[model samples]
Target: MATIRCCTCGSPKENGKDKKNRIEMRKKTKGKTPRRISLRASLRASVRDLLHMKSKPAFVNVSFKTDSSRHRFIQEEIAKYGKGNITSRIFTYSELCEATKNFALQNLIGEGGFGRVYKGYIHDLHQVVAVKQLDRNGFQGNREFLVEVLMLSLLHHPNLVNLVGYCAEGQQRLLVYEYMANGSLEDHLLDLPPQKTALDWTIRMKIAEGAARGLEYLHETANPPVIYRDFKASNILLDENFQPKLSDFGLAKLGPTGDQTHVLTRVMGTYGYCAPEYAATGHLTVKSDVYSFGVVLLEIITGRRVLDMTRLSEEQNLIRWAQPLFRDKSRFHLMADPKLEGKYPTKALYQALAVAAMFLPICL
Candidate 1:
């Protein structure tokens, strides 16, 4: 028989090795303790799991944070993205639906290649806005929506349309923008009947200059630079004062970051307004905008759509028909819209025509 010694009591044991092994086992058992977790680590893990489960595509409509830390975080993030003062608001889909009456056809202002735009009043802001509901069915719509959000969120210019806020609820994607009272330049230029008050030369010139400055700002002022992919008359909106603001940034792209002079992209623009080089090779440069601007200037000068299928066979395409008339100042009168009727400054018109002519060959 073995007499055991308790390790703690230091009692004698006949089987010393067995007693020692028993003591060691007891010590090992005593050393074992329950694992503990940090509150923050546990919380983070839980949040990650929740986010994984809610994997649907959505936009974060961030509520304006009153907390100093949260506010500072937002400010820092906006600064990192090189954006100016942006008033943050998180509008619920229910609230917006109520405001626009569930995006009824009655609320719709216009429809374009991108999506349908609706007019809505944001009660908090106390202003009306144009809500562009992106079509989720098309890949192009999603691509354009992302591009617009990325570019517009960081951009702020007087001549550029203001992006008030955006919505991303499940498959629903919408962009809120400042509403233009007068609609697009194309609307006034082409859609209005002959009896309506046509755009005067002064207003037209101002529109041209304003549009140019907007494009120039995108090219020269914007960080990393941007090229307005679609620079047609329809994209130019007029305020109550008839001041032009460049809207519809869906096709906008960042300029080349490297030594490359141009960005190579798939051809994406209205048929007749796209630069000839870009249309042919998908190589887009700042000059592409200049080419489009020239086309618009031609339209303004001639009061002709870039492509008018209704016109005579010889004069159906504006650029092709008008390019030859550019050299003959005598033909400048022929190109001028009958509505102007010698109302514009001859020298100013002539100079503008000369500039448009110069761009034509390059664009062609």
Candidate 2:
């Protein structure tokens, strides 16, 4: 080895090379520092932008005139309802959207003529809720919304589905209800998928009794009496324990009062479930609901759809098919759900069939 120099003291040539290397390293770092800073800033900015987008409001109104006035009117009307036992909160449009995960398709649990219902988890309340958002394109409108709000807010019954809250912001109209884990009775009875189990006779009878009680409450207990023009299997929602609750008050109308035989209005209900008189003439009454209740009861007992095209042309309509059977006490056994496999008591079957027959429209 050549003569060893002090570690701190380098040869001139070595010093020159070391200095050059240090400068190059500094230059490289200096060049990349701004890029690194920009990248971090860019990431922060991106995050901010994403948050801003999510924070954007739904159904925003540039002119608040109409909305404010209408909102005031709604609040006034609701106030007139005297709160009663209705403790539904008025939720913001944004709150509902967030609760429903912006109304994601995957969150949708059910849909019908009224609108689509979404299953939502409300973080603030720490509860799951059913959010029913009315379809703008559907037959339902503000009138139906108001009817539902008024009817449900004023009426409280064990058999009635609970109204948790409502959202009436801008053009958006939504109703929030307690979640029914078991879904609708129609889901269990008709058009059932292979995976779904048929409802047992005991559950079916329970559902029928609960649904009848719901109708009875509307027709008798409610002030001015209410005619549930839209009563059917689909409107009967079931909880985890298979307890039934009446839902969808959109088509509900006040029953006739003081010697009035019926309330005359535009007829609106599911085709097969509508009472013949109500369908022919827009005359509605508690009896109309009774007729509908009968149809649903018949469906429960027979395990047939209200309108099944699969049957022979003459036997397609459940009411027409059952009418003849209702006349002969011996034929009542034939009306029992085949799924029951004759497991139910014959006496119980006769009594249930008699009740259903009592509800049928007497054809002159």
Separately for all candidates shown, the number of backbone clashes (residues 3 or more apart, or on different chains) is 1, 0
lDDT of 1: 0.69
What tens digits encode model 2's per-residue C-alpha lDDT throughout 253-310? 6566556777677778899998898889887778888888889988998999989998
lDDT of 2 at 268: 82
Model 2 ranges with Cα > 4 A deviation: 1-86, 362-364
TM values, all candidates:
0.74, 0.77
Q: Lowest-lDDT window of 10 residues in candidate 1?
A: 1-10
What's the CA RMSD for each of the models? 26.6, 29.5
Q: Model 2 clash pairs?
A: none
| lDDT against the true structure, each candidate | 0.69, 0.73
- At residue 182, give the lDDT of candidate 1: 92
